[model samples]
Target: MSTVLELSDVTVTRSGTTILDQVSWKVDSSERWVILGPNGAGKTTMLQVAAALMHPSLGTADVLGQRIGSVDLFELRPRIGFASTAMARRVPASESVIDVVLTAAYSVTGRWNEQYEELDVRRASRVLAEWKLSHLEQRRFGELSDGEQKRVQIARAVMTDPELLLLDEPAASLDLGAREELLQLLGGYASSPYAPGIIMVTHHVEEIPPGFTHALLLDQGKVAAAGPIGEVITSEVLSGTFGLPLTVDETDGRFTARAADR
Candidate 1:
């Protein structure tokens, strides 16, 4: 499989503090990887580098065959799809859901003066329907529930048929029902052969979609374990990543974790 994302000894430092330390990993074109970690484990920082949104402070990072810092990020960004809370916060609250997805073609947060073609509008509508957001097409971004907003963000991210997709905590802050709905939708996407290679960061194992193929567990700015999902997502690894003794359970391709018995 062709490598879609590659990181070797990648590190990020800010204000004399290191967030990611010598994190080396690679993602291939056919894989969907879920990243698991605690709050300060540098999952988001690694994602920023993968999305070409931030350059690593040291070491080489590559996306879609282009090395970070040596490539034109403007040209590289469009080929990468990203959906995150940080990205969602930039969307205009008054923007209609359809327009929110439409603007992705231009790589903007809000609809603007750029003239959109009929085909663009059709594609946006098609994507909204795919993500089950068609019913909310005319709703303002802020008016929708958290689940609805998440689906819209994902729709917008894939609007450009990007080669790599990055999702950061797509199910965060949602009620149980809302989270399951979004996870079901994500599961369907993950199973699709045509979907782009994906990397999703989440705090909980239960949020991992059914079709995801790989897992990366991060602990304090470094990898705890990384490999096939069934191999790397064991109770021991999860416990190591989160700094707690965890009991991991899996049934029907979904996982759950809790404090282990003493």
Candidate 2:
């Protein structure tokens, strides 16, 4: 399988603080990986590196077969699909849902004078349909619920058919029903043979979708464990990663975690 991302001894330091330290990870085109970590674990920092939005302070990052520092970012960034609450916050609230997805064709956040062909519009519409957001195409983006907005962000991210897909807490701040709904859609997309390599960062094991194949656990800016989901998501691994006794179980391809003593 082709390697989608490779980070070797990558570290991110800023303002005299280190966010990620000596993180060496590889993601192949056929794998769907989920990153699990607590607050300040550098999960988002790692995602930013994968997205080519930030450069590592040390080591090298190769995304889509191109070295980050040597490649032109504007050309490289469009090849990676990224969804996050930070990205959603950049969207112009007054923009229409279709516009939100369409702007992604040029990696922009709002509608401008940039022209799009009929093909682009059709693609955006198709993506919205796939995400079950076709009915809201003409709706104002700001008017959507948290779940709807999250889906819109994902739809926008995939609009360009990126080679690597990265999601940061795609299911955050939603009710149980909405979270499950989004997870189902995400599961279907991740399972597709045509889906690109995916890396999602989430705090809860419950947020991981059914189709994910790998797990990377982080603790205090270091890799705790990285391997097949089943092997790395065990109670033993999680309890240590989180600094507490924790239990992890899977049923029907879904995972649940809680304190082991509970």
Candidate 3:
């Protein structure tokens, strides 16, 4: 399978502190990956690199066949969709849900002109519908609940038909029911042949949707384990990665993790 993302000796430092240390990893076009790590593990940094939002300080990073640093990020960015709480706040609160999604096609966070093509609107509507936000198309972006807003952000990410999609903590602020609904939607996308190579970052195993094939575990900015989900997401690895005794279970392609009671 072709490599969709590649990182060779990648390191990221900020304010003289190492955020990601010599992380070498690859995501092939055929697999969907989950990045699991506790807070401050540099999972978001890794996603930023994959999304072309940041460059490695030490080594080479490539996405969708283009090396970071050498390519025009403006052109490459549209080909890689990124959705996160951080990104959601960047969107204008006044924009309509449909326009918020449509702006992605032009790589703009806020709508400036109301001249979107008919086909673009059609595509945006379809994406929103798939994400279960069709009824909120005309609602103000800021008026939606956290769960609803998350779905809209995800729909916006796929608006440009990206080659790689990065979703950071998609289930973070949602309640159990909303999280499950979002997970099912993500699972459906994960199994789609036309879906982009996906990398989702989360701190909890329960947040991993079905059909995700690989896992990358990070601890204190270092990779603790990386491989097939069934291999790397074991109880032992989970315990080590979080620095606590934990049990991980999987059934019917879904995963769950819990702390081992003392």
Those runs of model 1 whose alpha carbons end farther than 4 Å from true positions after fitting are none
Error of 1 at 20 (Å): 0.7
TM-score of every prediction relative to native: 0.98, 0.99, 0.98
Q: What is the C-alpha lDDT of each candidate?
A: 0.93, 0.95, 0.93
| Tens digit per residue, CA lDDT, model 2, 56-141 | 99999999999999999999999999999999999999999999999998889999899999999999999999999999999999
Tell how far residue 102 is off in model 3, in angstroms: 0.5
- The clash numbers for all candidates, in the given order, read 0, 0, 0
If the candidates were sorted by their lDDT against the true structure, best first, what order would they fall in?
A: 2, 1, 3
lDDT of 1 by residue, 1-262 (tens): 6899999999999999999999999999899999988889899998999999888999999899999988988899999999999999999999999999999998999987989999999999999999988899999999999989999999999999999999999999999999999999999999999999999999889999999999998888998899999998888887777778999999988998889999
lDDT of 3 by residue, 1-262 (tens): 6799999999999999999999999998879999988899999999999999999999999999999999999989999888999999999898899999999988888988758889999999999999999999999999999999999999999999888999999999799999999999999999998888999998888999999999999988898999999999998999988889998899989988888888
Q: Clashes in model 3: which pairs?
A: none
Clashes by residue pair, model 1: none
* Model 2 RMSD, rounded to 1 decimal: 0.8
